[model samples]
Target: MRNGLSTFWDGRGFDLLLVGIPLAFLIAISGSALVYNVVMSFQEVGMFTLGSFVRPFAGLKNYAEVLSDPQTWPILGNTAIFVVGSLSGQFIVGFALALFFGLKFPGSTYLRGLFLVSWVMPGLVTGALWSWLLAGDFGVVNFFLRSLGIINENIFWRSDPAFALWSVVIANIWFGTSFNMILLSVGLASIPEDLYEAASLDGANVFQRFFTITLPMMRSTIGALLSLGLIFTLQQFDLFAALTDGGPNNASNVAQYWAWQLSFREYDFARGATVSVMMIIVVIAAALFYVRSTRHEVRG
Candidate 1:
């Protein structure tokens, strides 16, 4: 009996080592990249005849400059609005669509295929298509509005400060909703049918079952998806770049967009790194909260 248990333990130890080796390498690589970025945030450069090279030991000056800048809070506020608007709109819309599709339908398979096309398309193409449709002049959307006599004048969706942020937000919503739909649909499918049947027997209506049963059961899954979504949305830059270019007086500028402008547009790499590091810290904090909450649920 002792010899059999020892043999099983030896095999388990070998399997653990096999799994741990690749995971350790991945961690090492990821850690090195983060350290490199943090170092670069404190990096400085000076021009010389040959070329520019980083000056060692700039310390906290880069971070201090970012903190003292007047644009920081405004940019942060815009980022907050963008993240919240996108997440809320996407979650509500996506969950609704997922629920609708989850119901028995004749052409549900075809509908799901169509939904997947949007998710599979390139982000640049999606942004470009939205930009064209939302253009103030000679755009299909403006023409339709005019045809309906909704407005005497064409609305400047991209240029006007009031509409610029929302214009970008709308495009982001279209792009991100598919992701939520897929995730929530999977969660909805995972739910046991017997629970729903018991609820139905108790005379629970659609809304009641959703609120009391579906939501509570799916909370952990929803939390996990939202946590990842927040990280991705907070780091959003591509749609902004392709659609608005953070244009019309920086009204639509997000943290990621601002960081890009600082680095490549303004040629201020150090400040850009500082901004990125700040974003990383914020995302990490949110992720930590998600983990803690999820763990508590598991324990309880």
Candidate 2:
């Protein structure tokens, strides 16, 4: 026992032990939940059966039913649109801000810090604020667009099928940009300054240096960022609840929200769990990629 204690203190086993503890805890809590959810997806789960685990087994009927639903495809498509739009906007805008702040002008740090206000704000609060801002009548967005001659009339951003999804997309982008910026900023900081100096000495312009030096160095960080962003975007529910509620004939409904509606609103717990299982399956790939990216990151 004394030798085991000494070995733990002296050997790398201690590091393994530290890692294993949290992993065990995660499997105990999250793992149990996931296993139960999968079981519920296969078995029949309802309000009355919620107290027991010995519910009727339905096999793949729940999965088949969920997949066969007409709303399934459209909601999944909206989810795809939301994920793509939000990530694209957030990363592009965030990368631009990261590059701008990388220049290190006076007060740049303070200014960059201020941008985190968006990150700190609650998602529902952001959604409510955007709901007002994107309102068709008397909205600042419509007024500005009209003033700038960008639009001839007010847009029913939330209610209109054409713009409903995009409204949530826009809000999500603004909500997540700060987080993206912070991660990209750290990635930027980690890059060797000497590489840029050398590139500058070699007559490389700002654009040239960024493409060759900045991007190559940031590949790992970008991978990790995209993976995490995918997970977050898939799990997103609050903003949809606050802003669109999958309105205008399910035009803006996504898998997460739809699953919730089935589970809680419609009391189709088995189908809901099936939808959730699919989401988890989709996200697991991204999570694995993020882990792999971190493992393969270059260290100086």
Candidate 3:
């Protein structure tokens, strides 16, 4: 009788339909989609229409051509500069703000709210407004500078390749700092007060206590925040698209912008897919490294 009851329950509909089937379906669908895209990247895919297939097996030739292109390396370099510069600035500024707000100050709460307004704004609008301010002639920046006797004429922030990248970097830094600030502030608030008291008892200064105790306690949180920051910054496109449109001879062109240009402007879907795939690989690699490093820290 026990054996019979066990067999009946095992054959019931709940296990197969609710649990097993959906899990299998999800795995199948996600796996198939990933495999299909990876396969499509090997062949030439058109932007407008899928033409008749002549030969689909192109192998690593697409990847090789993409790597061999002169523009690829430069675009990647710009992406690196944008990511690192924006992230570094954002972290430093955010950490400072977090530290400031962690202390009691008049109107500090209101100031923190005001500071987050930039992060709340849409990326396209942020980029467009910054672009206007940094415009060469007739911009408010140039007008104000001339009024202050700083410059006789407008400065071409976009036209000058050297300044254009920095322009976008500044915009991104302004927008991204709030992310780090919020995360770090939460981490700071969560830290136990007893640790600080103990440090004070030991005659530790603010800087020393922060470095020795606060930093160690907040390490995991900071690591997570930084990983998320790197991922978002690496995939940054809307800001770049709206600000410079990868202009001035592609000086500000990043891998994301380059992919969009190829797919839409140049009408080369195959190459665009190649760029996208490479970006995926790079992001995945970076994420793995970050996760591994953080886990090691936790273990040690």
Candidate 4:
């Protein structure tokens, strides 16, 4: 016991202990939840059966039923749109912001830091703020559009089926842009100053330098950012809950919100678990790409 205590306090045992703690914690928390969720997807779970270790075996019944529902395809499509639209908007706007800051004007660091307001802010708070901004009657958004003659009347951003999902997409872009900008800025800053100077000496214009030097250097960063964005967008539930509630005829419905609605609201545990499992599969794939991107970062 004395020798073991000395070993633990002295050298490799400390390393082992540090590693073991996180591993054990991960297994205890995420591992158990993942396993239980996977198991529930294959069982016919109900209010009464939910308490049991085993229920009626469903096999592929839940999967089949979820896939067959008419709303299923539309919701999936909406999820796809939400992910793509939100990520694209965030990336484009964030990349522009990053490039702007890279120019390093007076107070640029402070200005760039200010844009992280959305990133540090709570999702619910952001959603509520946007809800007011996008409101039909008294919304500042419609008022501005009307003042500019862009729209003749108020646009019910959250309630209109045609605009509901896009409204959420807009808010999501605002919410996520800060993170994208910060990461992209780091990538931009890491490229050697000599490269830009050399390009400038060779008569390369600003656009030429960006395309030939900045972009190629940023490849791994962009890949990692995209993969992270995909996973982050998929897990966006609070924004939908606070803004749309998957309403206006489920027009804004996506998988995460729909999964919650199914399990808790509709008491369809099996289907809920199945939906989450499907999302998990997509996230896992995205995670693999993220790993690959990071690996390439090392190689670069």
Choose the strongest candidate by TM-score: 4
Better of 1 and 4 by TM-score: 4
lDDT of 2 by residue, 30-49 (tens): 99999999999999898889
Q: How many clashes in each structure?
A: 0, 0, 0, 0
Instruction: List pairs with backbone clashes in candidate 3.
Output: none
TM per candidate = 0.87, 0.94, 0.82, 0.95
lDDT of each: 0.84, 0.93, 0.84, 0.95
**Which portions of model 2 miss their true places by more than 4 Å?**
9-20, 298-300
What's model 1's TM-score? 0.87
Q: Model 1 clash pairs?
A: none
| Per-residue alpha-carbon lDDT of candidate 3 for residues 1-300, written as tens digits (9 for 90 to 100) | 987677558876455557877788888997676565566679877754445555456788888989999998998899999989998999999999999998869998888989888889999999888889888876777789899999986788776888778888988999899989998999899899999999899999999998999899988878777878888888788788787888778888899889889878887767887888888887787788678757965697
Candidate 3: worst-modelled 10 consecutive residues by lDDT: 47-56
TM-score of 3: 0.82
